[model samples]
Target: MTEPILPRIRPEIAALAPYKQGRQAGPDAFKLSSNENPFDPLPSVVSALQSATPINRYPDAAATRLRERLASRYGVGSDQVHVASGSVAILYQLVQAVASVGDEVIYAWRSFEAYPGLPLVAGATGIPVPLTEDSRHDLDAMADAVTERTRAILVCTPNNPTGPIVTSAEFEAFVARVPADVLIILDEAYAEFVTAEDAVDGLAERVYEQHPNVVVLRTFSKAYGLAGLRVGYAIGHTAVLNAARATGIPLSVTAAAETAALASLDAEAELLQRVAVLVERRTTVIAALRAQGWDVPDSQANFVWLPTGERTDEVAAVFLDADIVVRPFSGDGIRISVGEHESVEKVLQAAQSVVERRQ
Candidate 1:
């Protein structure tokens, strides 16, 4: 049988590779590919999920209660909070609402793997400004990349895959340079992991309220260990969030997810203590990597960036062979998430092997 010639797919999308998530690990393998919380769910979260009522009914389409809880926690109004299936879904909504054909969404290259696709899905051009050699966002260059056709700017703090954050002072200056009309999304998916003294805390900075065009995207997937629930939120101006809301899938947040999120918030102190442990583990991993002659970046997130450069794929295979899973960006680097304590030793062992082979 002959295949149909005109699938009529958009040429740009047709040529694009589908977004690749971190590789799943086998039974005996330690999965450190995704920057996910390593801890098991809090007792409170499990209790909430088990106690969820009316599973047959549709969730509150607006996630109203969760929004109110988050707004109060973040010191914002409920109208300013937007919760969705996940932060990625929020990103699509924001992009679709703000960008269209010929419009542009600008973000740093080697940042979040998801940012590029959001614009493509929205029929907007994606302008990926290169990250600095040190694997940090070049905000000055990013600000300069903005043009009349640019509709949005995505800023990923403690940027995914690469762990460095945009400092508070740097971000404030960069925001000052961006036009107030363009949407600025501060994707802080890994915010809870950042222990740095100088990183920009978008929620704490009150940039969402101070800058009408800015929005902050956060997720329960990372620090809260609720990745399986797919609940995340955005804090923005009421009007701006409404535009995103218009583009979202209705009733995307499930009752189970809503319940888990509320419970997680109730257990915030305990969860953050786990975050502190991961922070300490990350520090040790970075130190070990450096001592092994690998020039790894200081990661504020729950992952370390290994600039394997041209040997990225080769280095990734080494870790895989060691029964360790890690995310590899071909021709660029690998992102190794901080995982179980045993996994840390395995990661360091692999790093040592890689360094020895290179030397």
Candidate 2:
């Protein structure tokens, strides 16, 4: 009998647990786990999709037209924009382009879970700097963590998990200290949700004009109500954009996705109005949670974070029992995405019930 043969895999890959997404528990479950737009797609965008045909043909490999549109909007040439399947894909490509085996990539701890994994997958080391006490990115600490072997640093504005933003001044100072060769990726997936005056613009207009090393990542997923469509892009130096494109898989972005993204850009005003509504709801939810004595951080993103620590699981369970799906970060915190009015009310009620029972 031949000995049982098992396929060998990378130790990190074998040890990693699959990423879990928020599940729709039932038909009536109020899902506030994944930070998605609660609004429907704009009529113009919908019509554009309906009009699109020939799904048989492959998508434009370069995403040329879409890149042109983005470039014009951002006041850059076509060479500066690199569209991808989504911002996450662009992020992965960035890691691969800049990081080599044993190089270090630094980012804030608990900002984006994918941050740590992206560098690891590129055969690079990740150095996660701890967040500040107020749950914002500690840019000072992150800048300090950069060393001779550091190749890249990722900063998530209106950061995931905590949702606070890094100020423009803070970001500027941090970038000044980082080595010119080290690429700085400013992941602005939640940029549209921010309303603060000091929030980093993330278009890379100011930063890129002065510092060629900074790259800004944005997506049509959240504000554009195109999460399912999977379209995002990177704005940076033409050189960095070219490097990212070099590592990109051929035909990674589908035709439908490109159509949706272009249409969404045309409907930007309407989508921003919906984002305003979400911001209002986020404010309401955060205030309510704080009133209930929860340690809620000041979030500029579409979601709110409650640092319940070990109680996170229990809180999530309570919401689940109430048919409201929330995301709990094991022993770290619980994140609830702000949704439509009724869904927001349901979350509040479920939270109240849980807190009352605990009291």
Candidate 3:
């Protein structure tokens, strides 16, 4: 076959693979693949979505109401709050805003899979600092990796896939080491699920006030069960947010998304009650896994990491056979989202099967 002529594309972007999401499960299977809230949307959120109509008109390109609401809750100006389709969208915007060709963006390895791609999209080099043996960010090592070419650093709390958080003191110390000019993004997608008192609270700690370069990215996806709607926001310096806004695709936040997010906030008390339940489930799942002799990380997020090592795929097969779909990283491990209560026993059963095989 003759080679087809192709449009000129950046070699780096051409080499990149599109983002892969967790596998969808069969109807009878429990999907613990994505770290998603197993619970259904709250009634208030549902009502808001139902009432949202006239899709004929374009959405508020600014996401004005949602930004104002988030601003009030965080005690920041609306100008400082940037709402996007999802926190990950803001991640892309922030990276594009600061880093580009020849610049470097630093983040922990085995973290949110999106981290590596964000830098690549902006024509920047990604400097991934490996996690500690315990699956936590080595803040000191990350700080040491910084160079004059470094433009941004991403910190994912309750670090994804591995499941541990950087403590407040550790973050403060890390921040002191990084130059004030470097942008630091705090990706707190799972913040609402964190139970650790010492875990860095971006909003509560007011880190942005002390460090203008800091931007906190949050989403209504996990805790609020608005994953499908894709509403996330960022709290940071107005100028920084403005830059992100300039780079973003306009009117991406649909009216339904903003309305549902607003409703989620109004029913925050009740929605948080659901989060509390998930937290309890997370606690139980972690304890059970630990008791089973698995070297599971101490996860404060809504998922637990199973370091299955070389047996990763084989172990994942075991779960699949048991009708429990899990997110498995080829040679590393599996990340099991804390899902429906009924699925717990099935998860443990499949896990026990893997343990028995090893014996």
> Who wins the TM-score comparison?
3
In model 2, pairs of residues that clash are none
Clashing pairs in 3: none
| True lDDT of residue 46, candidate 1 | 97
Supply the TM-score for candidate 1: 0.98
Cα lDDT, model 2, residue 287? 92
Per-prediction tally of clashes:
0, 0, 0
- lDDT per residue for candidate 1 within 125-234, as digits (tens), equals 99999999889999999999999999999999888888999999999999999999999999999999888899999898888877999999999999999999899999
Per-model TM-score, in order, reads 0.98, 0.97, 0.99
Candidates' C-alpha lDDT? 0.92, 0.88, 0.93
Superposed model 2: Cα runs more than 4 Å off: 1-3
Residue 98 of model 2, lDDT score? 96
Decide which is better by TM-score, 2 or 3: 3
Worst 10 residues of 2 by lDDT: 201-210
lDDT of 2: 0.88
For residues 238-273, could you state the per-residue lDDT of candidate 2 as single tens digits? 999899999999898888788888888887888888
